[model samples]
Target: MARGMGRWRVLANVAFAAGVLALAGFGVFQVANRRWQVQPTFHVRAQFPNVVGVEPGHRVRFQGIDAGVVAKVVPPGRPGDPVELVLRIDESLRRLVREDATARIVVEGMIGARVVDLKPGEPDAPAVADGALIRSEPAADLADLMRRAGESLREFDATATEARAGLEHLAALAADVRDGKGSLGKLIRDDDVYDNLVALTRRGEKAVEKLDDDLMAVKQTWPISRYFESRAYYERDKVLYRPGSHRESRTLTAEELFEPGRAILTPVGRTRLDEVGRWSKASGRSRSEIVIAAFTEPGPEPELDEALTQEQADAVRKYLIDRHGVDSAGWFRKRKIAAVGFGAEPPRFEDETAQAPSRRVDIILFTPQA
Candidate 1:
């Protein structure tokens, strides 16, 4: 009985060991193949309103190489909110985390793996912190894409309308060109108008040539015949020209008007300047006298103060000649003794420089002895 018990016990121990070995093998294999073999990585979140081809166990990659896996999909906030995707990235790539780096769900392979490809930020930037969230810029949603498409259609419609208007205007312009309406039309379609203009220009040139010839002929005959006749007629009878020419000449002086010291005016010698001024003005120009021709013995006329004796007249002339110069030669006019005028003053003209109670002047008229 003891021997039999020992055999059984040995067999039992071997069986138990085998069972333990199997369990240990299973536990080690579980840790290696599915648990410990997978790297522990931090969760990064991405929000999506729509994730068409993404699911848990979907491959995550940087470029094309596998780097991580999609771990969970949860609401961005509440249960009904837009979903946020979480990823588990291999720890070996932890150094690659950076703030500007992004994770995108990308189409991969021929079958197209739904992937989270991490784009590394510039190396100069700071690394991403633990449990950090990554922002997702997703493909356009259906409504937004449709709205953009509608906007594009409206823009295309507006462009087409403008193009149609331009084409219509061009067609009208082309018609105008055919019909010879505008300046451009005239340029394109109306050679007759241009020809008429050219012909008119030629005619004008010929007319100008004829006019020049006529002018030359007129010029050739002008100086000797026509001009001389015109000049004689203008100079002779035109009294207005005489005074104009006299005025244009330099003023004549008193000496220049007479030869040597002899005066040109009789008034300066026989009478005062005032006496000559009275001839036309103060006293009348017409003179009358009652001459007594002796019909009987020479008798004194009533108007004469008794004809003075020659000696008496000589005596009177001598006294007068001493003070007021006498006309002893008697080369002056005899005058009626109505009124006598003496020295005169200058005539008044408009004064450019005026004064109060302005300066005075005297005027006089007189008769001269004959």
Candidate 2:
């Protein structure tokens, strides 16, 4: 009888040991799966325009902390409705999730798993009820980003290739000029050509001056003077070359306008702008359009340079409008005032070259022809 009792006891011990091992394994599984919660959880709903790989069992976070899991992903019943996501959040976070809270599907780490990131609302806002909808922001489309990046890379590669070819051509031309082989080489090397060019330039200037004088005399004489006065005609020394209208421009160099490498106006810059303001006030008409354009030297980053030029242009525009009382708008007509920046890409003008003149601002006035 004692031997029988011993056998029964051994069987019972084995069963007890097996049960203990099973319980321990269950606990480990629950902890590892993030389901070992002591408190209850509540449901919340969010709608997204694009889920982008989100599915059930995906983690949800509240301000970057692991707070829940997505319970369901319900597709729209009809068309145009957003995809709905049901989140099971810890009840402890109920007060923190207010009515104004926002949700968005974001990649957790650098190209890591995707999760629902929650941004809690204001503290004074009402707490969100269970099963309440939370506003969702559209997911950041990784595919679109990748596609744009690829296009930019291709464009950069093409630009680099063109630049290399241009450099090679320029190097060959320079060598030819040095060897005095081409027409340009001869023009640069010959003393007689240089002297003739200088003399021709002087003669051209004199002719222009004489023409101006003769035109002024004619305007001041007889019925022409009366006609010009009615039309508000003024003598323009330098005019912008455009077909449709009369446009005049005052060019200001960056060296005299802004602090070195910065957008801030210097004392000299202010003085120069003050002179321009006075000119506009004295001669400008309300019906005319004023354009303030700024340019910068080409650099490695075109975007930064463009931004700087824009700021400079805006500064000039602001000063002219605010301080000088330049007419930016008319009573019955739309304002034609505009500010633009062309970084490293100056528009074609007379005697344009790759020189310091490229880095400058032009205040242009466009007036209707009488």
> Whose lDDT is greatest here?
2
Each model's C-alpha lDDT?
0.45, 0.74
lDDT for model 2: 0.74
RMSD of 2: 27.1
Q: Which lDDT value does model 1 have at 267? A: 29
Candidate 1 lowest-lDDT run of ten: 288-297
What is candidate 2's lDDT per residue for 252-316, written digit by digit as tens? Answer: 99999999878889999999999998887666776676777788889899877877887788788
lDDT tens string, model 1, 1-370? 9999999999999999999999999888875434224456666677777777788777777656667777787745665567778777777777787777776666565454567778877898787776787767674343454445434433443454455565556556666666778988777756665555446555655655565454435433523223322211211112112221211111112222222322232323224323323332333222421100110112344212112222122222232234343222235753221111001111132122123111111111122223
Error of 2 at 220 (Å): 72
